[model samples]
Target chain A: MRFTSESSADGIVTRDFTLDGIPGVLWSPAAGPSRAPLVLMGHGGGNHKHSPAMSGRAALLVRGGGFHVAVIDAPGHGDRPRTAHDEQEIAALYAARAAGRPEGPIVVRYNAHLAEQAVPEHRAVLDALQRLPEIGADGPVGYFGLNMGTAIGVPLVAADPRFTAAVFGLHWPDALAGHARRITVPVQFAMQWDDEHIPREAALALFDAFASKDKTLHANAGRHKELPRFEANDAVPFFVRHLGSAIPGASPALT
Target chain B: MRFTSESSADGIVTRDFTLDGIPGVLWSPAAGPSRAPLVLMGHGGGNHKHSPAMSGRAALLVRGGGFHVAVIDAPGHGDRPRTAHDEQEIAALYAARAAGRPEGPIVVRYNAHLAEQAVPEHRAVLDALQRLPEIGADGPVGYFGLNMGTAIGVPLVAADPRFTAAVFGLHWPDALAGHARRITVPVQFAMQWDDEHIPREAALALFDAFASKDKTLHANAGRHKELPRFEANDAVPFFVRHLGSAIPGASPALT
Candidate 1:
């Protein structure tokens, strides 16, 4: 992992880095200890690693909670070049939608494989993140990802035992169900009641499958894309309670 | 599952059905025994359960090989209604391609979730197919799903032990790798050398991941969409040899 650029603003130090060709960003609180706890944020599908939703949550952790935050684009997403299949599929999906037709098997087939690859890729990123001295090698860690991130994070948290706390949002059940059984970390899962994408029953099924001793389901009234703002409110506190109390919520005095 | 429409042509009985809400089709050779071998043919992404490619294979097995064939649409596809999210994402993907910009994160996130869901959807269709008397409860079974179908087929074949043989085409590595390990059945995997979609290395990785003792890799020269014509020529014989001897390639005598 190589740190390519670093800058500081308003007590937050942000740096962009590359790990084995995967580009990502890290945000740290300036006055925090060199060994502060860290959190990994994941963006939703069709969005980059530092999508506004992901970046906003990272900002909350850095400014409100004095923790280090990290995020990376899943393969063929964000700064990475998408594949020809991907390009064609997306175009077709759009055409179908524009023509008021269903995308059919295209979206599911396209997403499932990427989700499968993203989980291991997230672990690879975690392997590299542990080497950063600013975040401390042995500090407790947390994860927060939704939709595509949830698909990626669920398998990742299940496979890796390092995450002490996690927030999985906007995801539904399938192959990820069995993996949920292996996760023992404290978890906060978010869902939208009127989610245009995910089925309500599937979301409930996924939440029920988590083997975590302590897990909370945060259900809000909105669509899938409208979830991030509502998420940051609960997510900050969820991470603070499990990882540490160093971080504030939106309020500075909360910490 | 409700069999909505049943039709007979050229001594082949083709039935259209909807399992719960998922639309599907079953092709059965009229003269075969009640428990003749059953093979499921899956369609590619952006195509319905009975796309010309899928239907042609079904017709071959039923007429040329004297077997039963089944297929279904992936969620948000086929007769199913596409979601607002699916349309928006596809449109965005197309715009990116049209502008010569990479699709990046959009494709990965969109596909990861869909791929995860499609496998089970395929399984559900399989479950429905088994209940039909035309195929019977305990007949030999094989699978053939390429591209999007391959994505769904890999996981379905891994989870279900009922399959004795399979033909996976137009696929690549990642999620399918681990799933491939559980498949100990006789398998035939196909690819294209100059394919416009899947990466050659990724396809090789998927082929290598299979734990099957008998597996053959067929690499031809063509684009992604042109695979069905080449595949039908070989896959028909493969299923016949492994599952049972009933299919004769494109012979008027058999039909």
Candidate 2:
């Protein structure tokens, strides 16, 4: 693991790093306990590691729950180079969307392919991240992702025992439900009740597949892209509840 | 409205009152603005206005959101006298429970019948409560109820325009779907994914029937009676978001 750059603003310190050539970013409180729990976030399919969604949620986790948050670019996302296969899949996805056809089949197929490579890369990143002096190996870790993020997260959390909690949503069950069944950690899943792309039944099925005894499904009334922003705020407490806040008295007032 | 008893404890003032022979209780912040928003709550079947769920949630609204909370006993509940009809329905419900039959049908039929009477009573109480100097008629009001409360709240909120937001769940939609369609206020609904009494499809159907442009469903992994306690805490922010807190900067940190 090698850090390329660092910056600080608004009580949060941001560090950019690369491990095995995979670009990643870590966000932490500028001033707090030296060792805090870490939350690994996976960005959406077309988005990079530091997309607004990732940074926004990272801010919430860091400021609200006083936790460290990190995100890494997927194989063909962010600053990474894409293979011919990745190019073909992206073209197919765009073609489906442009033709007003179902995007689920193409997205499911493409994301599953990416997950095959991304999961092992994520484990390696975790191994490297845990070695940092500020983030010891034994601290609780959580996963937060939605849409394509959920697509990759199900299999990752299922295979990785170090993850203690997860927040996932907005994806179909086609390629993920089987892995979801293997996940036993507490989960907070979000979905669009009237999502145009994913059928409501499919979303429910994925939530139903989680083996966790302490799982909560948050279904908001909206189209696929119209997921209410408050869901992001809601996830902070879920992590606080399951992972336990490392910063003393840092429990947030949900806005 | 007439107050029969009053007590102050734990930063909340509790007042027992009656309007035209109906018994009810009101909870409010001991110190804050002279006037605050109000939330009307409904208790479950076989439960009274002062059940633990009622007082517990009242504490949340009063201390967390700085709102006044009120709940009145449905006809044949709490301090009220039961009619022969109420007695018969209670007996039938008990028999079904003892026989290990599904309780949905009995609970639905009985609660719907009770709601017919309770709706008008709730309106009258709201009118009298608003007449108080502290809770003017113009202040925003919200409704919070589950189980039989949802049964009563769906119609009550549908019929009353004064209510700006509501939290409802845990009832079959057989008798309430039509009313739910009429409610356009923002809503936060809760249900058990594995509820023994209500089918999963039934719960989803009720949530789908809501016409609110902004609504959310929180489905936890548990049976009918095992709803996590944090949901009550979650409702405070929902009310605060919609009604606008009156207690200047008194946002309670979520535990």
Candidate 3:
């Protein structure tokens, strides 16, 4: 793992890095204990590692939980180069959206393909991240993602034993239910009650598939893109509960 | 309303009061603004105003949100006298439990009957409580109740326009769907995913019936009696979000 550049603002430190050419970013409190829990975030399909959603949530984790948060560019996302298949899938997704057709099938298929490659990449990244001096090998880790992030996260979290907790939502179960069934860690899943793209039953089905004995479904009343901002603040407590904060009483109730 | 007794402990002031012939309890922050928002809570069947759930949540609202919370003994509940019909219903509910039968039907019927009587009683208590100097007539009010509370709260919140937000769940939709459809305030509903008495669909249908534009469903993986304690803490933020806190930045993220 190699950090290419580093910057600090608002008591949070942002460091850009790469491992095996997979670009990523890590956000941590500028002033806190040397070591803290780590949360791995997956950005949406069309978004990159530094997207506003990722940075905004990272700030919440950094300031609220005093946890280190990291996000890597998925294959063909962020600053990564896309293969011909990736280009074809992107075109198909755009076509579906432009034609006012349901984007579920295309997004599911495309994200599944990306997950096949991204999961191993994430595992490798985790291995390297754990080796960092500030994030020792035995600390707790969490996964937070939604939409396309959930598509990739369902499988990724299922295969990764290091992840102790996860927050996922906004995706269909067609391609993820089997993976969800294998996941036993605590989970907090979010979905839109009136989601435009995903059927309500499909969203509920995915939440039901999680084998975790401790799971929560937070369904808000809104369209797909209208997930309330407070949901981001809500995730802080979930992670803090499952993964103990390194600094006592440091977890801010960002709500 | 006339205060019968008063006491202070753990930063909360507890006051026992009565309106007409109905008994109730009020909990408030021991030190805060003279007048804060109020939350009216309904207790489950077979329980009273001072049930652990009621006092526990009252502590949260008072300390976490700087709000005054009141709970009245429902007709035939708490300190109130039970009529022969209440006795019959209680016997039926106990019989159902002993026979390993579903308690949904019996509890539903009994709670509905109680609600018919309790709704007007609660409304009168609210009117009386608002007359107090500490609880003015114009402050926002929220309703919180689960199980039997949901049964009663569904109709009560629907009929009252003074309530600006509510937290309800863990009840069947059969008798409450019509009333739920009339509530348009923000809501936070909770349900145990594995509740033995209420089917998941029934719990969900009741939540769906609410016409509130801003509503959230929190379904946790647990049995009927195993709702995680964090849910009580979760309610603090929901109330804080909808009903503005009286003391600036005094709302504690009790999570």
Candidate 4:
């Protein structure tokens, strides 16, 4: 576990770090004490730890809500080394999309492929976070992610008991629906009503499959890429309500 | 080759026989000549060769259009012997459906397991049909099926050149999507626009993935079961147009 860079602005501190080669960013209230509630954010496909949506959400969680936020680039994505297999797979995807071919199979296949590696890789990161002195040995954890995030989160969260809450995004041809029953944590799943890539029925079916007693579906009428903004408002409160009790060091700047 | 029962009524001749332990039904113009065009039909899941829908459509096709149709029991379905594996799989499926679990994975996994034998079983039936003198040595062949049919048909049709055209029903949960481009025969893919069991976008994507230049989508506003009746009208003409050039042996009685 190592911190490579740290910057502060508007009372929010952002730190760039890597744990055993997993590149990540952490955002926290600049004045918060050691050990704060942490939210791990998963980015969409073709995106990295510092994508606009990921960084912005990280900032919002820490700067406005006085919580801690963490994000890591999914394997084969930002800061992570690529391989010939990844390059060939991505080239085929671009060709399919450019030809106006069926997008579901292409995306579904890619998400499924990414998920095989992302889930275990994420667990490693979570294990690393547990060892960080700044995160507080017993800090409560939540997850925020969509698309590629859910592809990875669906399996990771189902297996990991550390997270108390999660906000899942997109519906990635629904590769992760099979794990829905195993995700016992309180969840807020969000999706666009007309996701161009995933069928609406599959999305609804995915939400219905979740066995979580406290799961809620937040659907908005928009395209896939525009969904995060609509979900950000509710996500904060859900996490804060579930994880806030442990964050006794709420930044005085926000208070 | 021996017909167990043959009945001629409603201008249709329906025959029941066992082909090497595979029970099947054949419908043809009551007075058609020995040689006629053939359209191999595939039935939905949990349905048999003589199921009301199967027999009804077979009757309608032959009676209404003077064509010959064939349907064989998919392995472990209809008259085929069910193994312990089949029973165990069915028990699990019932539990999943009863608990409202994600049907996609359960069904996809079951169908894939079945296809390991079902595809070859279907091809074996086609091989037997070739030995029957009544179907004619020169008769062109086509395929019609949906649901379990499409799951098996997608792969069989992609490899079998004996079929000149096909009408695939149900959105094959996409385990077979990888073979979409191999199906170069003219295809009339049918699906219910709001099928309770199928995602429409996946259906559209499947249609788009087909390499066949002559593929068409025959969509209707109904559920999975409601789709076949609407498609029968177009399916008959489509098959006849593609396979009829050689079936000039018109059964004078029907005309």
Flag regions of model 4 displaced more than 4 Å: A245-255, B1-255
True contacts kept of 3: 0.74
State how far residue B74 of model 3 sits from its true place (Å).
1.2
Docking class of 2: medium
* Per-candidate alpha-carbon RMSD to the true structure: 24.9, 1.9, 1.8, 21.1
* Candidate 4 per-residue lDDT over residues B63-138, each given as its tens digit: 5455688898887898788899888888888998899875667677777788778778778778877777767656
Per candidate, the number of residue pairs that clash is 20, 0, 0, 0
Best by lDDT: 2
Residue runs of model 3 more than 4 Å from their true location after superposition: A250-255, B250-255
lDDT of 2 by residue, A1-255 (tens): 999999999999999999989999999889888888999999998999989999989988998788999999998998999999999999998898999999999999999999999999999999999998788899899999998889889999999999999999999999999999999999999999999999999999999999999999999999999998878888888898878786676534332
Interface RMSD of each candidate, angstroms, one decimal:
29.0, 4.8, 4.5, 25.7
By summed lDDT, the worst window of 10 consecutive residues in model 1 chain B runs over B246-255
Per-residue error (Å), model 3, residue A143: 0.4
Backbone-clash count (model 1): 20
How well does candidate 1 match the true structure in TM-score terms? 0.47
Could you report the DockQ of all the candidates, in the order they appear?
A: 0.01, 0.56, 0.55, 0.01
What share of the reference contacts is kept in model 4? 0.00
Q: lDDT for model 4, on a 0 to 1 scale? A: 0.74
